[model samples]
Target: MDTYKNVVRILDEVLSLEGRSASFSRDTALLGAIAELDSMAVVSLITALEEQLGISIGDDEIDGDTFATVGALVDFVDAKLKD
Candidate 1:
């Protein structure tokens, strides 16, 4: 499966973006740049990613940088999957 595509789908669902997330590229900014990606949405996105990707994310493994962009989030998930 395409990790980036999956991540985008999860983001769309969790953030209720109504498919708007489909247009996001690797450079697409998230977090502060995106009004929908507040604290609550971050938690929801994490939960959705964990459940959908069947990966466990430790509390300490995440930081602001992880959600800084679409590429960053996908890289974070890919790294977690490698472990």
Candidate 2:
């Protein structure tokens, strides 16, 4: 789950949560559920994940569900890496 940890780090930094993301779990709420996960944050997160994981995120691939939870996000990143 290295990608998961990397994403969590990105989220933590993007949201300025002071490492609060360390406490997040698979079921943790994201996207619109998190105050800091606005449109700009989404763009930043996508860019960070793409750069860090060396994967391209398609424009059509962007969706709220992709950022719904830690597990979902991990799954997305894993899928991208596999491609």
Candidate 3:
């Protein structure tokens, strides 16, 4: 499975982006840059990602840096899947 694409799809669904997230590149900023990505959204996103991808994410594993960019988020998800 393609982790990057799956991550993007989940982001779009969780954030209610309506396909806007489809254009996000690796460099595209997320947390602070996106208006829809508030703290609650982050939690919802984490839940959605965990449920959809079959990965478990501990609270300590998350931080602003994890959602800094599209690529960073994908990398975080990839790493979580490995464990």
RMSD of each predicted structure: 0.7, 1.2, 0.5
The lDDT, on a scale of 0 to 1, for candidate 1 is: 0.93
Ranking by lDDT: 3, 1, 2
Instruction: Put down candidate 1 lDDT per residue, 1-83, tens digits, no spaces.
Output: 78999999999888889989978999999989999999999988999999999999989999999999999999999998888
By TM-score, the best candidate is 3
> Which residue pairs come into collision in candidate 3?
none
Could you tell me which residue pairs clash in candidate 1?
none
Which whole-number lDDT from 0 to 100 does residue 76 have in model 2? 89
Alpha carbon lDDT at 31, candidate 1: 88
**Candidate 3: which stretches are off by over 4 Å?**
none
lDDT of 3 by residue, 1-83 (tens): 89999999999999999999879999999989999999999999999999999999999988999999999999999998888
TM-score of each model, paired residue for residue: 0.96, 0.92, 0.97
Q: lDDT of model 3 at residue 30?
A: 97
TM-score of 2: 0.92
Query: Which residue ranges in model 1 land beyond 4 Å of their true spot?
Result: none
Give a tens-digit lDDT track for model 2, residues 1-83.
58778888888987898989989998999977789999998898898888877999998997989999989998888899999
Comparing 1 and 3 by TM-score, which wins? Answer: 3
